[model samples]
Target: MCNLIGHALQQALTRRGFIAGSAVGASLIAPMMCSAVAGDDELDTRIEIAQSSGDTASSRTRLLLLGTAGGPTWWPNSDQCGISSAVAVGDAYYLVDCGEGVGKRLQQALLPANSRVMSANLRALFLTHLHSDHTVDYPNLLLFGLFTGLDRPASPLKVFGPGRRGQVAPVFSLPGSSSPTAPIISPDNPTPGTKDMTGYIYQAFATDLNDRMRDNGKRSLEALVEVHDIDIPQIAGFKSPNETPAPPMEPFRVFEDDRVRVSAILVAHAPVWPAFAYRFDSEDGSIVFSGDTARSENLIKLAKGADILVHEVIVTRWIHGLFPAPRSVAEEGLMQHLLGAHTPVEEVGGIAEAAGVKKLVLSHIVPGNATREQLSPAGKGFSGELVIGRDLMQIGTGQAAAPARKG
Candidate 1:
């Protein structure tokens, strides 16, 4: 089953795709790839319906998992939504990583009866990186969200993400495969960060935005969103040597408000430079997000002593099966990047243990159909609680309020 699923997903992830090439459009073919290799339809239907397996607790600070699947593919046999999460403190909530399906998930997670808007209580949004899986629905958040009260916030909705990489990422080269000479996309500005990407999105939807503002009198999206590119602080040993750079560093402040103090540290997701792990400290407790990384000491440092650590996990067994033995040099190169950039389930527990976190919740899981036991290796070396995250699942990070007397 594992090999079948991995191979199904590999069809979505080409040996020369995503990691090595700047082919964001390649992800558009993911669903077709998944369908081409999808297994029994009846089995797929059963699992898809059974995956939403958790509920929330009443507390001042809570962690909500909006979606848990990783990668660009919409896995065929899975019910999980894309990778997104929220931290609710009192009445307002902060969001991290707006993946596909975020809108529907947010509505289920926060929208009240007779209410159509999900942004009324949303305080801010933070992006860990520019990966398509993480930011695919971002434009939807700003466009559709406007009708759902995104434009009604007392102040502009704050958004922050990595700044532009100084240069375009070099193409991949293996010993006996294709040349690294593929033509670049958007050559003039091959790599734009959060602020630039947001502007481009607005422009792409200018007709809709303009019509809404002129005909419907909706607030200008320009006036509703405030986007900022997070500036990286200097790191002593960091250098981009024909590759992306991530060096040892302190967690620098990225945002703050009366509810939470947010700090971030660079982690190793090479070729995807400026990837970050964020920590949110509130009066209730601390929660950290390991954006997408291999075992990172920088992440361990930032999450140290936190109440919860939400991290990404990929199945090593899946990788092994995804690329069977007797693979080509190019295949091996892609495999290596997949292994290096993502944390294996076996090692994730140790990362949580090293950070002294109270609990480790795994999200952004690859091969989204993986079962609980398949993901259980994440608890092998950790003493803390190990949670296999599910969409709509909620865990309290702060003290829960006492129940009102029934009488």
Candidate 2:
């Protein structure tokens, strides 16, 4: 249910996972789906929406839901953008994932307070996995941000994401049926991680990047952003990505600075090894992104005691409805695959409770058009506040940093 890519041969490989965001994907379930993803509800309880743009220009931290829709499918009639969120600590903000409409959403949500310049204060970007939805706009951010304010920052935007999946996932097969042949795409470097992906983008857009530098005197792409592949901890149970995507492990530090300390742990977004859940701890409080996972112990451990847990939730009922009863074995297998990778609305509450977070905000919502009634159950077991995430909504974390006192 957690949020939400593009084309070419490498794009074809990226789109290999369940994908959409096209005219065809928009009509994938045109019959049963209808409405926007804002969820049919007004603000209630701990939900914080910025009344004036000035509210977010603070020393305290805040969580901005830039694009809440999950999945590659572009749902019909839903204006919900793909899955992207930001943890803003004062002027500088860190981004988690780059789903569809991320650039535009960033403009709408952050530009006003940020001098209307893209990447003016974009401190960093952390990708949970290599899913098309999570990374579709990544290329755009690099390719486009340079023209905006990418080089305006004092330092490069440090990027972190999962490393390569050494082995390809096993193909699915129905009972008593032979496994289908799985063709490897780009076998020479079949599984590229964040660093490799960034490098490839540089190569793919070399002509354009060169034009900017040679013609307009812009800084090179490498000077604008620093990218890294998050190394998987070699845990005892972990064998290979296909064998065990995420094994029991402790949260490890990935990056840090004066403002926030970032830590990460492997979460189970199966077949996509080294999927991660990240935690950002600041003087204000802790905010954690569950990324896209199906209730993994590693995620729970990573999110323990966080102030705000921005977790992903799928409407389990909607998933079931996708493949109605009397489904063929292949249909049934597909249904199980969807269910296995995501946490359901009914289950996320318990996971949040287990993590002892003070507030649980659901994002990367599946079906984009899911109703509040269908999502309310997420609060049943959760003692903390529940926010049915909406695109561009703002929720402050911890106390708003006090204004400076006059002498």
Candidate 3:
């Protein structure tokens, strides 16, 4: 049995193109060999033990959950806020989604407010999809950042998100008509891509932006913001506006700088085509954000061997309790839409397990006040460390210290 196991290990290393003489190859092979010999159950047990002991290596990257509520609305008395998060590497911060009140949350996180420090350090913004809940505070982030700190940003603020989806005909057209005469309508008109959307924001705030520039002697906010529309490479059953296919199952590098590299993959968020999950890789470690999705295999491929998986999770059973029983057809449809788009807590664990992430942090939590008993369903199959996210909670990328809970 020992000899057979050794043979299998040798074959696996060879298949992976690992050189026997290379120290890096040997380091990689050692873990695989142990896993193969101990088997999955033993390996999982070891992982659980290590997690329980808080065995995490120290690194420079940090994740802060600015808000953890699943939807756009924030309750008056609840501690939960709308969805937004920031991943900081060294002194630079990258924002993912800008839900309502994110600016205040940033202030609460000790990020410089109305200061030059904020302008210089708040590096870039990444939008997972164009949901209102994810983008409600975009204008605030863009405008507020200018005056909250010392001075306006010297460089253009970078924004990235998936390109617009192609227009589709309305479900209901004029009865007995072969073609609908009225122009095709969507949730938003012109199906503006991210670039266009950025421009529109600039135009919408032109008067105020100009006043800030001329009156306050500030830089042109319009000129200082640059937007990039991510043209999601087409995959089977996932079509982008361009209709061109990229290499299958490969992560697309969307942004890179001296501090970190950002890669994205198309995730399954049906009826909202071209939704993306982003992975940020820095010197400390890699962190992946699932934005909002439902059982996306591409996300698993993108997140393989990642240090932390910050995924959006919802408990469908609790969803009904949040709203009155679907009395109207529209209400029922809304519930169905919610059910179809978000990932269940249990499925979130399975995705983390499949990706082999070290820590699973659940954010954008549905029914914000979910109890431990309510969330236990997610732990049924996952053995890695699990963190129930809350607003202003800071998680270090490397060391497995207890998350610093603030606010």
Candidate 4:
């Protein structure tokens, strides 16, 4: 029986497949019923919590977890590898990454369409990079927000990000523009189907935006979703920069309101250049987010002594052990590429330790082997508090909470 169990474990290690984080607990187990959604449906009208005060003894800051997508495969129970960290600097919500199903998740989290993340009253969105997992829900944010009436305020959705801002120009309402398309995986449209998702998305809302403009006797809807494409440099050797200034990379700073200051630094996740690690600073405390990266000094530098480090990781030892056997070489190569592009668990712990973060939350998890038990081995390397993230699992700002025991 022991030998048979060993064989099954061997097979799991050998399977070559992409993994992603998903909601396994309440998100899946919880009924899909939207009872809370039925009531008033006002996003900003929900519960309120006191925020931590910052510098000058005048302002306060808070953060809310929206979407939790990680792992190599998106769980049927959860969405893909997308996470939105919304920070409240006094009275605004600044979104970190808008991934697939983010709209629905935000609704579930009850962050109303146009309401600020905190009680203060501001709205902003920031994208860490343009990976499919990170930005797949880009258009949905606009379409859904408008339909739900969240985009009706005077303030346009303030967007910030790294690189090629509007270079591919989002499919706009204006005619004569080339509409954006996506590959279709259905047999009806046989020729390697490329369906225009954005076009369809806009079509769904074209009537509303137009009709509203006519009713209001204005050029357009009361609130228009604005896209500000920030440019992140696509450079080589950013991992080991030999020179100062680093070619004018603009770190993300949400506000200069000295009460609460947020900053970002670029980290390595090649061939996706200019990945970011963001830091949130208030007088009382601070938190850092490692957007999506492998091990790098830049992240360590960015996270230095922050309250929390929300990081992404891939299991290396598990992958190496699993793929060195009989299988397609092409599959093996792809698997190796993924492994190379992400942080191993040991390195995740090391990053946290070196950065001196008060606590460590391991996110964007790519579990090489099934079961959380297999992942505990990584804790041997990281002594600080470690959390194996699950979708919608809320965590508080830094006061060390011990990691859950391995199953």
Error of 1 at 320 (Å): 1.3
Task: Tell me the tens digit of each residue's lDDT in model 4 across 64-159.
Answer: 445555543465533323666565444445667777666655544334334443212336566666566776776777645655544445666665
Clashes of each: 0, 8, 9, 19
lDDT of 2 by residue, 1-407 (tens): 22110001122111211122233332332322233323333423323322222433343788877788999889776778899999888777899999998887676665433343667789899999999989999999888888767875468889999888877777777778876877888899988999999999999999999998989988898877989998765688877788878888889999898889999998878877778999999988999999999998989999999988999999998988889889887797677767999999999989998999987888998878777667877876887777677666566666656774448
Mark the 10 consecutive residues where model 2 has the least summed lDDT: 3-12
Task: Assess the local accuracy of residue 264 in candidate 2 as a C-alpha lDDT between 0 and 100.
Answer: 95
Clashing pairs in 1: none
Error of 3 at 110 (Å): 3.1
The C-alpha lDDT values of all candidates are 0.78, 0.77, 0.68, 0.51
TM-score of each: 0.84, 0.84, 0.76, 0.62
Checking candidate 3 for backbone clashes, the offending pairs are 113-148, 114-147, 114-148, 114-149, 115-148, 115-149, 115-150, 116-150, 116-151
Query: What TM-score does candidate 3 reach?
Result: 0.76
| Candidate 1 lDDT over residue span 1-407, tens digit each | 11111221232133221222223323433553454335555434322211121113446787877878999889877777899999988878899999888877777666543466678778789999999999999998889889887877467899989888867766667656556676788888888999999999989999999999999889988888999999887778777723436677899999999999999998898888789899999998999999999999999999999998999999999999999988776797789888989999999988998999987888999878776557767777887776667666567766654453446
Q: Give the runs in model 2 whose Cα sits over 4 Å from its true position.
A: 1-59, 113-116, 152-154, 325-330, 404-407
By the lDDT metric, which is better: model 2 or model 3? Answer: 2
